[model samples]
Target: MKYGYYPGCSLERNASAYHESAMEVAAALNLEFAEVEDWNCCGATEYMAIDMLPAFALISRNLALAAEQMGNGRQQQLVAPCSACFLNLSKTDRYLRDSPELADKVNQALAAGGLHYKPGSLRVRHLLDILVTDVGFNAVAEKVTKPLYNLRLAPYYGCLVVRPVRKTPFDNPEYPTSLDTLMRTLGAKVVDYPLKAQCCGGHMTQIKEHTALEIIRRLLKNAADYQADAIVTLCPMCQLNLDAYQDNVNKHFGTNYNIPILYFTQLVGLAFGISPKKLGFGKEFVDAAPALKKIGAEPPPKAKKPRPSKTALPMPAPAEED
Candidate 1:
């Protein structure tokens, strides 16, 4: 019931709602999350490409910290709510165990801080993996105060969660059903999403705008084509690309899609009878009020002035100066 929580960069900023809702859900399920002390960034998706040894060393630092926290001898069950964090940590752990040379190099870097990580000493996992495997859907369904009746949701797992099949043996690489099953457990009708495991073009939007839009376009178009009310996601990167750049996708394709990309944990929080305000509901660029109305979930309190049109949402800009 206890886990070492790793709320990566996104959870502290852009995907704060996911972190909020995840903590809310964990509390309701009687799960305890002790955040890893002095955890660092997992180098995200871009850092690895920039430099390999540094990226592995950076990611290893977090794993080393998590293992150190499990002072009582058992392998630490470190869970991350962000997909990028999960992939980086999980991949780092795997690579470290698989390659002794790499493991030695990472350990040497850690020795500078008087820390040395033993590969395979920490059980790195995603929040979704814990919920489905450890918490169980039946237990989740039992706690639902308000089932998501009649809500047709597309469960978008995106690429990172299940890709590189060897990493996530439990999930099908081509089409995973864990998210879809989780939504159904909340009483929402799960749409058959063909692009469920497709890439969200992580960092591609910043690198090649048009190319990223096309990749995002396919996912959005597929969801709309299936008549899904909204897209529920497990990854912050996926959620950001789909939700924040939605307008750009529309502009590129000349399509008017207002699909709300929501964190899967947010819906779980709703079913557990948590308030929208606590779940960070109104923070999304795309308003989810229209879709939530279908399930009778309370909308965010309205502002006196009208909300801006989707086009008026701040465009994706270059990284701002600190």
Candidate 2:
């Protein structure tokens, strides 16, 4: 199976591990992902809020590229690993398909860039969707090199992928089952987290620290109640919010929730016997070393700390002298 991959900006930067694991997993699954050429942004949360038409056009422009670059004009698939990107791409296609007025407006914007997107030309899916629905949970189970047996995982859906159901194309609105299925395939017990779809307060963490911490507290609290060893998620944003801010959340809430929030790809890479380095463990703030330790995968080599730049001479322009 061939898919068009959109790594999004974050994956190239903060989520490099996601990109690495995705490649390893794609190889393991025997599915080829040909990245589309020169793809633009998906117009994430910010664009839609600022202006709807151009935002949809930007996302649709990507969809149009995915459609045009399909290996054989077969089923067009865009493997979006980020929930926000997936939601925006999927939402725009769905909305445009149903709303002619909106479609016309978006297409008009596309005209400026000499790009045109036909509604329903392609399908936008989260990485988990492709893993579970396209690849099948059983196939994933068969690839387990080391089962995460007895590891309790809280499958967090975050708000973007499953919420505002009208936009997402995956499973049930209120309850998504992909992550749970993927977890079970890895031989771990999946906990039914009530706060799975609850907002992690996303980028709002910086804008509204207290509220974001509270929201994060709830998710960790529920995961703790279920005694989850780790929180598995599909979005880099959710993982960043929960993992990077875990210390702050615990500090504020007076609770020590030590659960590691891991991208599902990291888990899959582990299960497939890929080295932890390839899975990008060192990049995480809270340190998944101990967590990966529990599963018998050795920790990645400690990344070298950067050396400070040497003192520089003061700027001086030779103007002169005599």
Please give each candidate's TM-score.
0.90, 0.86
Q: Least accurate stretch of 10 residues (summed lDDT) in model 2?
A: 313-322
- What would you estimate as the lDDT of candidate 1? 0.87
Clashes of each: 0, 0
lDDT per residue as tens, model 2, 1-322 = 8788988988888778788888888999998888888888887688878987777788888887788777334558778888888888888888998999999898888888887778877778888888888999889988998887656788998888766544545777678787888887886767778888788887788798998999999999999998888898888888889888999988897898888888888889888888889888788877777766566343224456555456756655453211
Where is model 1 more than 4 Å wrong at Cα?
A: 164-168, 296-322
What ranges in model 2 sit over 4 Å off? 71-75, 164-168, 296-322
All candidates' lDDT scores? 0.87, 0.81
Inter-residue clash pairs, candidate 1: none
The prediction achieving the highest lDDT against the true structure is 1
For candidate 1, the per-residue lDDT at 17 reads 95
